[model samples]
Target: MLPFENIILIDKKSSIAVYKQIANSIINTVRNGVLKPGTKLPGSREMASILNVHRKTVIASYDELEAQGWITVFPRKYVMVAEKLPLLHPKKWDETELAYSYDNDLKINFRIIDKSWCVERDTVEIIIDDGHPDVRLSPIDELLKTYRSFTSRQPAIKSANKGTAQGTVRLREEMVKFLSITRGLTINTDNILITHGAQMSIYLAAQLLLNTQSTIIVGKPNYTVANETFIQTGTQLIEVSVDEYGINTDQIEQLCKKKKITAVYVIPHHHYPTTVTLSVERRMKLLELSNRYSFVIIEDDYDYDYHYASSPYLPLASANHQGNVIYIGSFSKLLDPSLRIGFMAAPKNFIVQCTALRKMIDVGGDGYMQNALAELIKTGELKRHLNKTKKIYHNRRDFLNDLLQSQLSEYISFTVPNGGMAVWITLRKDYSVKQLQNTPLLKIIRTDEESNSFRLGFASMNEQEIEITIDLLHNLLKKQ
Candidate 1:
C-alpha cells in the first residue's frame, strides 16, 4: 500500500545496474527512517508492475536486499523488512503537522565564546544609530543599472568565475586610481584587498599581524568592535588615553620602550565614540615611533569624506612610513551601511598574505556588485554622490549642534565634531544615558554608561526628523 513506485525512482540509462539502483534506493529509505523495521514491502511481481520494470529486475533487487539484511523474503510469502533490524520510528505518513517542531530555547552540547558585548538591540520606530549614512541619499539605482548591464554583457559573463580572491580586476583598478586622487594614496592593484566591510578588513589585519603573545596598543575607549576583535585574538590590549588631539603617541613610545609592540590601532580621522581627529604632530610622531620601534599602525579612516570645517587630514597611509601602516577604509559610510564594501591598502607582500587568508573565510565577494561600483567610480558618479551628501550631512551636523546648544545645553554637553556623522554627547552628572535608553519609544544604539555619554546620529535624519527627536528627548528630560 506504501508509495513504493514514487519513492524508488529508476534511471534506465544510468551506468549503474537497474537492480542495484533499486536496492540502493530501498537501503537509503531504511536509513532515512522512512521504511521502518518490520514494514511490509510490495511483492516482486507487484513492485515490477508498479515501477514499469520487468519482474526479473525486481526479483534480483529483492534478493539483493535480503542478502544485505535490509529485508526478509519468506518462501511463498510477502516480503517485509528484517525482523531483527534496529527500529527507526518515523512520523506517520498521513500526519499533517511536522514531526518535530523547532524550539528557540534548545539546549546545546558545546561551549561557545561569550559575545555578550556585541548585543543587537531590537529596532524601534525611531533609531539613533552610531554614525551611519542615509541610504536614501546613495546612488544605488545607477550602480544597479551598471550591474544589470554587466550581467548581460558576454565579457563580464565569461569572467564571472575567473575573479581573484583579492577582488575583481575592474574594481581594483578603479580603486587604485580613486585612492590616488581622493586619499593621496600611491598604490597599484597589488596593494589593495577588497573585503566585506571595514570591520572585516580590520579582522583580517588583526588575525595576520597579532597572536596570543602579541601586544597591540589602541586608544582608550576605542571602537568597541575593533577592541573586541583584538581581544578575540588573545593579544595584550594596552589602552592609551585619547585626548582632544587624539591618541597620545608619547604613551605609545613609552610602551614601545617597555615591550615589543606588535601593532597600534588608530582611527585618526574623527575617532569613534569621541570624534577627535589625530593632530598632524601626533600623526608624525606615531610614524616616527613605528619606524623606531618597528610596530605596525592599523589606520582606520572610516568617515574621511564629510569634513565641514575645512579639508580633512590625509590618511596616515598616505604618509611616508616605509610600509609600516595598514590603511582601512569603507564605502559604507559614503553609501549605506548595508552596502558592505570596504578595502585595505597595505604593502604588496602583506596584501598577498591577507588575500590568501581572506579566501579561507570568504572565497570571493559579490563580483557583479564590485564591477558595478567600479563603473560608478570610473564615471565620477560616486564622487558626485559624495559631494551632494557631504553638503547635506555638513548642514545636518551644524543643525544638530545648534539644537543641542540652544535646547539641550542644561542636560547634555558635547564638542562639535569637525567631521563624521555622529556627535559624541556627554550627559550631566545628575542624569545617566541609561535613562534615555530605557525609554520605549526612542532607540539609541551606542551608549557608554561608564562615560555617561552616547553618540547621537544626525546625518540620517532631516531637519524635521531632528526636531522631532529633540522634542522627544526634551519631553524625557522634562519628565525627570
Candidate 2:
C-alpha cells in the first residue's frame, strides 16, 4: 500500500476540515505525479491509524475522492484510482480536432516600445556598469543578523500582518529621523510613502500627476527608464538641454510660458547619466517657477548617500517652502540593488493619494525587511556601513581618475565627478561608440548616443580590473 502518512498532512487548527485536507493532499499527490494512477492506498482503518484521525474521517476522505472521480470503489472490497484520470491540457479541444494557429489569427494592437537602451553584455567577463555600487562592500552579514532577530520575535512577525501600505511604522519613523539628520529635511511620517524601489516611486508619481495630453519637462539625456515610465502614462515629454551645471531651468521657464506644464522631473543631485549637480541659482529659480506656474517637481535623488568629494548639495525637497516637490530616493545604491528599499516624500495629501494607489498595485513592502532596516538605523549600523564604504569608493574614484588621465586622455575627455559613483567620459569626435565596439574587449561598456559619452562605473571594479579596462581602451583608441 502507498504511504499515506508521508503524502497527507492534516492541519488540526486550519479552517479547512481535516477530511477535506486529506482529500486535497491526495489529489495534489496524484496531480504532481507522486502517486501514479492505479497505485493502492491503505484501508480506512490503516490510514486512520497512520494519520492519527478517526476511521470515519478517513472513510469520508475516501468517499469524497470517489465522488470527485479521483478513485473507484468496489462493493465491500477494494478502492482504486479511476482508469480515466483528469489531465490538464493547454486547450480542451477533442483529440481529433485540428490545432488552432494563433499566429495567423491574432494581430497585436499595442505599440512595441524599443528597449535598445539595455545593453546585453553577459558574455563579456569584464563589465563597466552604469554607476552601480560594489555589492562586496555591503554589510550583508549584519543585515541578515538583524533579519534573523526580527523573525525570532513572535510579536514582530505578528505585527507585520498589520503593516500599512505606506510602510511599517517603525521604518517610516526611522526614515523621518534619518532624513532630518542627514539631508536637513524636517518631515513627519505622514509625508512619506515607502516603495519597492525608486522606479516604482517614479511610476506612482507619473500615474497620479499625469493624464493624457499632459506635458512634463525633462532633461534631453535623462534616465531612460524614468523617461519610459512617463511616456507610458501618455504624457508628452519636453526635453531641455543639460550642461555641466545640469538641466536648463531657463528652458523649463520658456516651456512654462508657452504651455501649462503639468510637472518637471529632475535629478538635482548628481544627475543621472551625466553626473552634474544642478546649480544653486538654477535650483532656487526652479522652485520659484514651481510656485508661480503651480507645477509639481519630481526630484529623483537616487545616489544621495554615495557622495565622495565635498558635501553634496541638499535636495530640492529639503528647501521647498512651496510644497510642490515630490522627492524620491533609494538605498539600493548604498547597499545592494537586490535590497529594494526606496521612499517618496511629498505633501501629506499627495502621499495619501500615492499610498492609496500603491495599495492597488502592491499592498505593502516587505515588512520584515523594513523592520530589520529600521533596527539597523536605530543601532547606528547603517550609518557606520555608509561611512566605511564611502572611504573605499572615494579611493576607487581617485584611482579611476588617475588611470584615465594617464592612459586614455588622448582618446576621451571626462570630468572627475565630485560626489557620484560614475565618471562621465565624452569620446573624441573621431572615435565613435561604433568604432570603440570594433575592439574585441572594449565593447562591453555602454555608451550614450545623445552626448557621445560613456558612463564607466568604477566602484564595483577592483584595482586589477580597472587597470585592465583602461589599458584595453587606450590600446584600442591608439589603433584607430
Assess each prediction's global lDDT (C-alpha) against the native: 0.90, 0.86
TM-score of each: 0.80, 0.78
In model 2, the clashing pairs are none
Candidate 1 C-alpha lDDT tens digits along 76-187: 8899988776445566889554323352345777645668766666856678889998889899999889889989999997665465589888899999999999899999
Show where candidate 2 strays beyond 4 Å. 1-113, 437-446
| Count of backbone collisions within predicted model 1 | 0
- What are the candidates' C-alpha RMSDs? 8.2, 8.3
**Candidate 1, superposed: residue stretches over 4 Å from native:** 1-111
**Residue 216 shift from truth in candidate 2, angstroms:** 0.6
Candidate 2 — what's its lDDT?
Answer: 0.86
